[model samples]
Target chain A: METNVTNIIIEKVKKSRISEVDFSNLPFGKVHSDHMLVCDYRDGAWQTPRITPYQGITLDPSAKIFHYGQSVFEGMKAYKDENGKVWLFRPDENQKRLNISSKRISIPELPREIFMDGLKTLVQIEKDWVPTTPGSSLYIRPFVFASGTGLHASPADQYKFFIVCAPSGPYFAGKVRVLIEEKYSRAANGGVGYAKAGGNYAGQFYPTQLAIQKGYQQVIWTDDNTHEYIEEAGAMNIFVRINDTLLTSPVSDRILDGVTRKSVIDIARAEGITVEIRKVRVEELVSASKNGSLKEMFGAGTAAVISPISGFGYRGSDYDLPEMKDSYASLLKKKITDIQYNKADDPFGWRFEVI
Target chain B: METNVTNIIIEKVKKSRISEVDFSNLPFGKVHSDHMLVCDYRDGAWQTPRITPYQGITLDPSAKIFHYGQSVFEGMKAYKDENGKVWLFRPDENQKRLNISSKRISIPELPREIFMDGLKTLVQIEKDWVPTTPGSSLYIRPFVFASGTGLHASPADQYKFFIVCAPSGPYFAGKVRVLIEEKYSRAANGGVGYAKAGGNYAGQFYPTQLAIQKGYQQVIWTDDNTHEYIEEAGAMNIFVRINDTLLTSPVSDRILDGVTRKSVIDIARAEGITVEIRKVRVEELVSASKNGSLKEMFGAGTAAVISPISGFGYRGSDYDLPEMKDSYASLLKKKITDIQYNKADDPFGWRFEVI
Candidate 1:
């Protein structure tokens, strides 16, 4: 793809931080690349995008983002193929979703050209930061926040858009246990749940912490109106495989429309698997667990790609799934990762090469 | 009242900005005082609180607060009475609620002594900035946000607490027209709606903007599940007066325990007016509005002690409230402000003197 890089202002770092980072034991979301993309929206338009050295940002103490949670972000990853070429998995999807989130939070939508050019230019400049390891990649964080100085309860007049990169290993280490939450909700109906709004994630930390204390790695969030339906798992969209059929909740105002989630569905359907996109009742899952039809459960997102679930706790009872020699989790993860890492054929045109 | 100012570190500004501010026409939350209080929580404890010149704060681009919305805040006021004495109305309540909001969002609870002493000392120093004009005062914003770098979608290890004051005029100019929102919601049951989390306010802006475009000043939110019951008005706790009785929704996990709300209830009850705290159905409001029994409607909060609603839009129809010669809104507002400004005797010990 030919990116319009002429419009983006580039300021390279004096010294690369790659030498200081120990990639062998990389932590998730801690280490950043040498440069970052920043754009300011003020005076009714987005300013020229700038790529500067990764550093701190200064804002007034009463910035709207600090008082009102008028912030939105996206998660994507850049991969390195065997031949040293850099690639981003469905970068357009992330750009689209970021604007969707921005609009929901009352932020002005970012222009597509700026988003694409800024992202591709930054990733190209820092292509060396893309980890060469088998399961590791450079995690890209594109976020926009209210930068207007005010304490009034309204939409901000100015906003700051940022794209920061972190090279890291997997989000979840291994197979995980999840608690089916009966109390507390991540999003509400007619709310900002579908958007990648910052508040959506903040509200989940406390409840997930409670689940972690109960010997669970994450919480499988249910609908706020009734705990009968399953919605999401932690920050990722969840999929439940009962017998030969795969089930996941439909995207609504209360559930995020994750990028990897749609890819998984498309890949699964192309592989001739039955995927049901509807509300999956907790009662059905509990019954399936008792009857031994629950084969596998997993979460899908940019950070994890596909995180297999080992077991789940619900209604004071723990249910474990039988280990399958030919589990769907492994098959789907390999297929998706193959596309992401540019190891397989790009049938769906999902890969965007940066270099 | 005596305060322990021994623990706080003070750094005065070289010169005051008071000369530049137009106190006669001060905008809400835009003109800030000369100094602000800041405290950092790290290494498993809150550091020494500092009162420094109000200035811009620098943070990492990857700070968790920018991405996850792990932020909470409180609204308060420092009122300068006729004798140049500053008083805070139920500041202890604001302190308690701030901690409550912090805990719900997984932020560390602020110690009571620090919150009290910091607020008192800061207000004392900036007392000259507090507007002595009628219906105008210095608005104090006490807020805490995640300051830790990294975006792994968990609770932040470091947090920043700040107290920024803005010398402002009244929040609302005149009676407002509110839209009874049935399509959008501010919060859900078992959600972070009750807390003054930044995300809660962020979600309301878009919906409120839509209402504004439709000729309404604010949105009267309804229950997320059914949209059949009244919840709140914009950022305030709502009250509906039917005939001679005042009806307000009970404080639950979804409704804020507003300081002004409770004060109005107490003052009204003391004045022998009937006050009912229960779930108020939208049907009841509509019926009362049709029957000419809906005498008054108002919103109560720190910014606006009482914002009277002149009319409301519901289901494609608008209902104009009668102009009562002696309305409950005017009466309660005067009684509350009397206590806040030290013009009336305090029977409930709601006023805390800072001078």
Candidate 2:
């Protein structure tokens, strides 16, 4: 059956697996929806998009993605309001960033129309998969990879774009303790850090594992050169609240321009709070923590709207943050989640209704 | 059938495709041989290895490799000597480095016995695929990637190790020009630059493409911090020759410990040429070029034994090196290739006989 949206071909699954999923207890990225959106790029153009059953893909062993890591992905979520309507939070930003990432890795930029049409159509078809539980939503993963079958170390001639949705709960359960990285780095000056490239995440796993071994949940990466400036936490943009003012590192070629990060800054400023986006120094954060000025720390991303960080370790020492009833993290998270779930008016026009 | 080496199960193809290949006109990595080696890591250990017909692999859409870039690879060559004997040049080095790369990325390491046995058995099975052309041989690509079916940003619970061979010619044909990069970087200070990680190569495609647009074949990467010190070239270790002395950067966390790079240094030093293994500054190179002290420059790697650089572009200025009668690149390449193909005495014991 053909849908009214952008001529996307639809092939529904014979049976839906919705009954097998336990909506009350959802793990992140484990339970995928019944249907997926797939599009192919060949002969210098993106071919027709299709919505098919979520299944395995076959590719030659010499496919470029397996060898060269020519892959890029975007993370998004669909929240079901109490009215059974679904809303997406600034999905246009993810679409734009996906193309930006593709261009950086030498993959052809995906047209915005294809991304949006395919995504919305797939979500509308699998609306039942969206969880209605508080703080649980359908985590959408839109990714593109080189499917060209060759080992030549250049750009590929064939590609595949896919959008898979998984019903997932919050990314972080409780407040996390992070370690300030002093040795390892996540990105370089003119690297793919700004883009949602696959390599950027792989490089962080080892360092994060080391931090986990040291009893921390994640590592707050530093600048590759000096390891002096606070960059971002694992898979999320970091924010520090000193007394009443908020501080975050300005987005650079070495840092991701997170949608959640921007929303937090905008929402905080709108609430009459000071939001300073600049190069955050490690020494400043440590001194602020000691002087009782560091009020709160949190990580912002698609999966976790605002993951409050309890404390941080740096240079063989641990620093704990004081608890507060009126924390900025809680305030910002409440605001963002309200907008995402369509419970509050989106003054920034960030929510997109799918139903 | 089962092979005697490590209990590897062997499955031959019903029909060999050797007759269809025009090996004399082979591209770098487009054509493959008849069989490949496969080993899986699951249930806390590596399972029995297998040799099967070269074919595509089936994987779930949410495989970690497609999302997080948990992949590593090694490049090698299998040469058939005049006496119809197959030989691998330093197979143990490739096996050891593969594990080092896996450990850094938190992937399970393949046992040394499995790697060696699988590689030799596969090569022996497809010995006819090893080209006999003067400058051509079978290009072996041994790679591992995360195959577990999940999209979580962590090390995969399952992995697949494969060895695929492509009968191909050299990577670079003629002398080429390179751009001395000042803005872009290939790796960070404490990153996976030393590993043959897939991300390292993917990060280079854009900068290399930009250099290609500027009429350069490759980009001579610099340190991420200052962009002052010379790192490696696109996928090969770089060497600069000043007068009769050879200079190359020492392997660090941000530079690959290339096998061919080490071989070149050892061969040059044994030939009574002064070799300096230290940091090569960009300004020092430009000064040497200006003073007419620079004799030659070349890149060393498994694919391209020695790729001579004709000239270099740095900061909008192009500098050409003087042509020489007795170039060091030609001398070292000949010495190394001779040892690899068993044309000369095995003084270094670099060759491993497969048959």
Candidate 3:
């Protein structure tokens, strides 16, 4: 059983595409690594995962993912240190969250061994793709979707889970301006908001496009019921710093329990900073901005790590946040990246070495 | 430009699979016709539409639809009359609704001519696949999804729109029992519920599975805010007959504007029945059930045409609806089927003949 679980068929690409890729000008999720990990779930059990060359796949027109949106995904990064050592930061959290999302979307749970082993094997094979440049890493996307060909609106009997890697620099630019959303909602209270489901992201595209037309880079989504409390900013969890207190929305079924957001909280507590997880109302944020107590605002996610909010637009007015020399965003970002790149002591044991 | 707009390259299947299918036991959305109509959108314009054999499509693993659910679809039917003529009921409404859904999900809108001509041509080519059975018809599904490779949480630069047909019998067997949902929600106010988006159906699978486990076939969804007012019943618009008046929830951004639902409303009003489109509260339903005012309940959709509700389960108690000799469900079902089959006069110009 152990051999069966660990036996992964390795199929390398004929010619590497690394030489053609410009590492300095890497676009987000555009250039893929040479190889990927693919696994099929059939007959109520997961088959042994295989390493294959990155390529297109054929699916029937009636595949459930195309019609029903029964899919979930996770995003993480692999960093290469000065000694050419590849490391993954807090991958166990991603595995746990993926299973949670799968359960909520009626997909079968994947064992942790498959996820870890697959990640390790694939990263080791494509270690050259992990850029060593500052503020750059190999972005890893692991997704599962219903591959069965049927139009019935039920849980599919067959599924495909795969992991693909891409060389990426940064998701956002230096700073971002966000619009406060009061009309369109991303997720409801008792919906798939907590899960990393594909449907949650698709619903936001139009609303985000509307915000972009209004000169905002992202939209800070509020609670669907009352549209009062802040939930998430774009695809990431938001944090607001006011009067030395780090405040973020509590993790509920309506808010995604972001790994970066949780790590920031833990790191802040360890560094003797007050962290409060509670309902952060829109009115409170507006008042704080008016009274000059809104010290900083940033978004936390695996893609951006830390996306600082330069200003926010509410109603018809724009409120600009003053720059700080020792902002919490910078402090937390440096601390996290230091641990990720093997430049600092690993206190919480979050690093996993690949090769 | 004229040639580009009207050109449709035809590619018929080498051998027809219709002989192998059992027309009596047709499954919903399983046995597809031999030909399909496909169109592509690229370079800021919709290319020429084409007719091709129903086969698998190759797509990159990073296709936007797989990760973000950037897809929309419409459902209608092709019925054969006794005189061997095929007719589509209210196809213009489906074309308009498909564009509406496309706009909400950030996909490019499909032209009405393309939609109409595509359906007409595909159904004309595979007209023999339309089952002549009383309860069977050729189910038409027109869907548009993002087919671009890269994934960046934005609308794709390319899209593929296609229409497929399947010979299907009734979607549900006999009358179905539904559970009143109070915990989970299908869509919220100011969301994508009004659109026939793929994400909307994907979210309902788990909740409907839970209801199935509890001896119910469907779930009666409620308002996301308070779960007080009834919204949609399963994938169809619901109607409750209370004391000679037909009551249903009014169309809103959170409620789907069902075509069959509209037809039923029109047929009911034409037959001198008082149709009230207002908020149907849960408490009012419970009271109606207890006081014997709830006469009949049914669901309206293209797949099922009209699904009679035998009874409903609320909280921990079951409410059984008494049988009626001339129930509104039967009358409306028969009237709609007659119009669909061309047995009755085409009073509303809802039927479009194909060859």
Candidate 4:
């Protein structure tokens, strides 16, 4: 297996694209690396994976991914430490979550070893794309989608697993101003809420755009039935600090089980801060704001890291949270990144160093 | 404008793909006829559309459609009668509903005339593909997705509108047995529940697959908070017939405003049946079954027309709904199909004949 893998790598290097590309002035997702990893699924098995130059793929209009939304993805960054070594932070977690998402969406499972191998090869081949500039890194997106040509509403027989790399930046331009949507929701019970599926993201566009029209950066979606409980923001797990207690929506079938969400929970515990994970009703937050108990709020995700919410409008009432001098969000973000960049001790064994 | 359009069509046909070929056994969505209609939003304007052959187009991986859940679609069918005529049932309603779904999802709208003209041309091009046999027609899928590539959680400045046709059979093979999901929901209030967004379908796969494992056809999702109010089936709107009245969930933002659902309501009215459109609690349904008031239940959608429900299981209790016979569901299905296939007078003006 090792020698075959080495031969595949040597072949990939021989087949690298001939395009001379400037890394600077590169837009987030515009400039692609020289090589990409492609794997095929047919006859109920994932065939031998191959690496090739970035190119267009032909798909039937009825391919299940385009029609049925049978697709899921993960976003992780490749960081270059001071020693010129590449490190991936808890990528095994992403691979596991991808499988979890696959199981929920009824897509075939991807073995962890295959997933890790694909990621390692793609990153190694595209090492030059990783930016050493401040607040910049290579953004790697691993996705799986159904690729069959039948139109019926069933799982696809053929699937494609591919890894694509993008030159990076802050996902959100700056700080965000969100609106707590009291009416619309993204996912619900028995829904694909916990998975990083494409459909879950697709459903949020119109409503989040509506919020954008109203001058909000994102919409904090509430529960479906009464629309009373605060579930999550569009891309991040939400946290509201009330009276020194961090309150957040409980992880359920209707919300994505975010890795950053778990990290925040752990960081809070490590800092001796009280964190409550239960159904945080929208009314409770409003009441806390009125009572002057609400101190700060932020959103946590892998892409944006930690985005502080400046203000939120709920039912047309604007509520601005007070800024904190010693914010848990900023603290956790630093601690996590420090560990990821190998600048701090990996007390939690979160960082996996790749030599 | 009309003359220019006619001349353009004639000239386009002069240079189109080789049309004289065998097209039987096309296999669902694999084959496309000569022309496909595509319109784009560029410079904040929806440019006039063009019709071209079905081909693969490439996009940046960061396209909002790929990353966010900003995609929505509608399923509508066109049929041919025995007298060598083509007709669409409620095409106007579908166009309007598509707009509604677009508005809810932040997608650009395809003008009514453009939509109708595009459908007519494509159906005309594939008229041979529309089988004239009983229960055979061409399935039309009109969908819009954000086309810009960026990792930001904002609505795309650009959008693409595409209408593709498929040769489809009955969606469900046999009488469907549903599992009443007490823990999951398909849509929620203040959510895109009533919109035919792609994410809404993706969310149902896991639970419905579980239902399939349990020997059920689909999972009937309930309202998210309490799982009390019945929302809809995976792809179709649900209807339950109590002793004499037809009880169905009210059309709310949390339930899809199915075109067939409203048609059934009109058919029930025309048949002098009492139709109640309100929240139908799960408990009330179970009680109705125990008391023999629940005579039958079925799902209404464009694909299946009306799919009868054989039974449902919920909360450790199994209830068997009798296979419908000489029932309102069957009668409405017939009356509705009459207009769809142009077999009867379209008193409701539901059928639009294409010249």
Candidate 5:
């Protein structure tokens, strides 16, 4: 990787406690590595960043994120194969998405090079945290927040950008059963649902808990204006297969544009699955299921990779989906995992390796 | 109000020097107070509270707030009225709302006693920072966050509850023009829009910025499913005057139950002015504006007691409201301020003196 971008100023590093942290059975998001990256903007100029010790930073109580919720974050993972090589799947897409989320939440832009450098150093320092366990990885969180100090219901004047890593295992290795929510929506046309902002998830907690209390594991949110169209399930983008045709909702301002969702779409397209990215209404899907046209449904995200939807509880009716012996979700998930674990050919150049 | 409420745990305070702070009329949020209150929850109990020099708390990069945005907060003001009487305007409402916000966001409930005792202690310690100038007050922020140590797209087990205060003044005291957005919605049915969650505000930053670019100062968000109903201004509850009757949208699951809005309703009723709490549609409002039935429209909130809307741009048309010679908003704002500053009779028993 290049040492610097032409216009950006990289900060100096202040090596923190070099004490080693074991990756063996590391719990997700509990242990952070040394040398976190930070950049400050004042007088409209992003100052030189510094890699400092992982310590608590002071913030005013009225900081915008604490009040207005002007915060957005991204979840990514870094993998170290048996050959001691580090691989980042679709890092560029993440940086771009972070920018989009920043703009949506009124946060300043983070330079792409800074994002990369920070990730590389953090992984190198906490390299042992990447577990060798199957279905386990190092979860990386890159977030930007409004650290401005005021009680006004407005955009913040200052911010804090950070990246932290956590060792994580499989979220849900087995199948997922979801409930279609015909009332609540995760986001609206003019809402922050699509962005990785903290508010969207906060909004879904109560309803999701209600769904969980009612025996369903997750709630699949529908369109805000009309609960007719299926948007997303929990925090992941969903895909349905109807007689070998892959269908998923088109990414709108209201729905998150997931990195895994895009990757799955590309892989499915390469496999000639005839993927359709458009509105897939609940009525149409429910009718197709009754008519025996709907084959299978699954969710895609960085955590789960891919999770087969075994069944869906619509209102009061539960529609049982057949477990395909040759499911597309399993196939795509395996292919993506293979590529991620460096077990498959990197034909599309999707994986970027850090030496 | 009660002496037995002191389940207070005295904690050590740490100081950090931010010598590089440029505080020359620095913009809001650019500077912070010396210390911040932090309390962590795990194992069904809150840990010993601590007040540390404001600094960043190390967190797993994959914390749920970063990815899912599961966070919520509250806004309340601490006033140093004349004679140095530190008063809180309806703190119980803020504490109750904070609990409700935490419940909806899936963050653990901060005990009522902790909220009250914490605020009193924090403000007392920082009492010298309380600005005494006219219109200046210490903005107290009591917030709870989902700072769990995992990233499974689920609710967090651990949380951090804090109360930070900022010395500030009115946000939007003067009148400004606003637009009625019939097409874009802020919250949806069965969503966390009513709560002062972070995600709700994050989504509005983009659309509100767009409105600002169009020369409008604020956006009055309507119902998502149908834009026919007028809901609220971007950060305040809206009140529309049709003749002598004041009408506002009822607090539904989709609308924030603003404390100021409720107070205004109570004052109007006390004055024998008929008040109605129901859905105010955009068409009806526009029609009323056309026939001179719309006498005035104003927004109510803690930050801005009553922000009169001089004009509203709706759809493809603009309507300038005629200024009221003796407006209800002006009268209510004056009465509320008088009570808050201990200048007039607090008929509603709203203010609570703290030492």
Candidate 6:
């Protein structure tokens, strides 16, 4: 979707936080950039989008989002290459997914023009916050929430859409450990699992907390019906590299159509590596691990780009993957970052230059 | 749970909106009471509860509730009897359910004293806001949400719990028509369907809106695995009276254990009516409607004590239930209200008098 960035109303920050930020000690989603974009939806139409100073906004305690959770969000990143050029990776994908999530959550679908225009303007304004440090970028969070003051079970009449950016480092510190969830399920067969919705993440916290107590940083969620098939690894889509073949679970109504996951599949196929997208069974993974065919297991999402899994625990047993000299995770992470930082050729034309 | 009301720090509203309220024309959840209770959870313990004027509380834009839906809430009411005494119906049940929801959503469990003391103090102080009109009460909403500023998938370190009251009339206006959902599911087996979490309600808004467009007031949500069994009607637990036996869906991980549903079952049994608590199939309900055995159908919840179902739409066909004098819904509504308003003997000792 083509966006007219000139339409954004700018309200620069009175006092910049850039001087205070410690780029070497950045935390994920804690520090905000100088400006944010706000758009209000009321009377069946979206108001003019405005880029304002990043600050707190008051909401009624009875807002539907507070009670019923009618909120949808998207996560993307803005990068600064070595040449000081600002770029956004696959932001159009995030805009499309946000509308899909809005439909699932009964929120009004944001126009592509507004989403793109707001995002580009906000990122351009906060370009300095785009850390030059490796693995760090401006983590852009564009979210829409119900803002009306009522407690009915239906959709809210008013919505507030905003694009907020935070300067962040890596999502995960290092190689992560995951637990295979057998009891608690993230999304159901006919539920809003595929949607990047607020409730979907909220429901996973308890089970995820339990996994954290068990010494795992994340959970590899299985199907709700039998817990026999793999679905996702925490918030990211999972991929299993068995020998020379790269296998990931196919996107379904219950699985998010991740941008990074799709990119990896395309990149692996382009690189002549075998890519299989199908329903992956838990038994198959365990057997492959036992037989030493499970070369590596990694998670793919916008936050980390490629989160290499060290090991996974399931049903009181742990399986560890041995270190490899040439791993797919490292290769793909390099390839993606190369295009993002403009070091390598953009074969897929995935990078969008902001300035 | 025993509550120590004397420990609450009360700050009365300086200027009450009592004179501006129109008791006879009350709308659900729009008008709030004068006072509200606030309790913060930080450093692993609940802070001292404080009562203040009903107003908006500022939250960081990066609060987990905005992005991850880490929130849970309970809905209840405080009825004013003809003698001007306020009474809470089985508040212990609400207190227990809130903590249960908290556990499911990874929000820290609220202490029994805090839940009870907050509710009692808020309702007592807002007694003037409780309408005298029949079918009207002070709607009490107790909610807990992740208040910390961050965008992690894990649970929040800081939380906020609030008890807010609104003057609301009946939740449902007249006899309601419902549609049997075939595609979208609210909750799944082994999911957080049993908890009154924000996500559970948020996920239903889209589907519920579709049902509304189809001229139905609510949707009778079916099981996620198969749309073969009837699970719930809107936000309430469902019951179908076939001949003499009152059949309702058994509480599972996918179905909320509603206070009014349980009360109806107990009241029906006490009145010598057979009550069957088991799995209720959709086919059985349609067949019962075809035959003469389908006596009545109703939804039970705190907001609407007993909402009678006029008809239901399923599989491109609509089935209507015949109106009957002395229907089970009416009988139970009167029975429950009688106990709630202190007009009859409290056989179950469910009433908790606040004044």
Which one is best on lDDT?
1
Interface root mean square deviation per prediction: 0.6, 0.8, 1.0, 2.3, 3.0, 1.0
Candidate 4 regions off by >4 Å? A1-27, A226-228, A242-247, A271-293, B1-35, B323-325
Q: Write the per-residue lDDT of candidate 5 for residues A288-336, one digit (tens) a residue.
A: 7898888999888887789788888886988888868888988898889
Q: Report the number of the highest-TM-score candidate.
A: 1
Candidate 1 regions exceeding 4 Å error are none
lDDT of 3 by residue, B1-355 (tens): 0113456889999999999999989988888889988999999988999999998889998988888888899888999999899999999899999999899899989888898888888898999999998889999999999998785778899999999999998788899999999999999667899999988887898899999999999999999889988999999999999989998899998999999999999999999999999999988988999999999999999999899999999888999998988999999999999999899997888888886
TM-score of 6: 0.98
TM-score, first chain, each model:
0.99, 0.98, 0.98, 0.93, 0.92, 0.98
Q: What is the lDDT of residue A19 in candidate 4?
A: 53
Lowest lDDT 10-mer window, candidate 1 chain B? B1-10
Q: List TM-score per model, in order.
A: 0.99, 0.98, 0.98, 0.91, 0.89, 0.98
Give the per-residue lDDT digits (tens) of candidate 1, residues B1-355.
3458449999999999899888899889999999999999999899999999999999999999999999999999999988899999888899999999999999999989889999999999999999987899999999999999896988999999999999999999999999999988888778899999999999999999999999999999999999999999999999999999999999877889999999999999999999999889988988999999999999999999999999999999999999999999999999999999999999999999998
Q: Each model's DockQ?
A: 0.90, 0.82, 0.77, 0.50, 0.49, 0.81
Query: Which lDDT value does model 1 have at A317?
Result: 96
> Looking at the true structure's interface, with contacts defined as alpha carbon pairs within 8 Å between chains A and B, what fraction does model 6 recover?
0.80
What ranges in model 5 sit over 4 Å off? A1-35, A52-56, A117-133, A284-292, B10-39, B47-67, B78-86, B120-134
Model 4, range A1-355, lDDT digits (tens) per residue? 1212422332355544435655555556556676777787899988777778766666766666666677888988888788888788888889999999988877899867668887887787787777676566788888887777666777889988888887675565566889988666777666678889887776777777778889998889887667788889777899988888887788888888888888888878888889999888888888888999888888988887788888789888898877778877678778777877778888777886554
| Tens-place lDDT digits, model 2, residues B1-355 | 1245588999999999999999779999999999999999999899999999999899999999999999999999999889989899988889999999988888899988899888988999989999998889899999999998776788889999999999998888999999999998999888889999998888899999999999999999999888889999889999999988999999999899899999898889889999999999999889999999999999999998999999999999999998888899999999999999999997788888888
Name the TM-score of candidate 2: 0.98
TM-score of chain A of 6: 0.98
Alpha-carbon runs more than 4 Å astray in model 3: A1-5, B1-5
Which candidate has the top score in DockQ?
A: 1
lDDT of 4 at A40: 79
Could you give the candidate ranking by DockQ, starting with the highest?
1, 2, 6, 3, 4, 5
Better candidate number, 3 or 5, judged by lDDT: 3
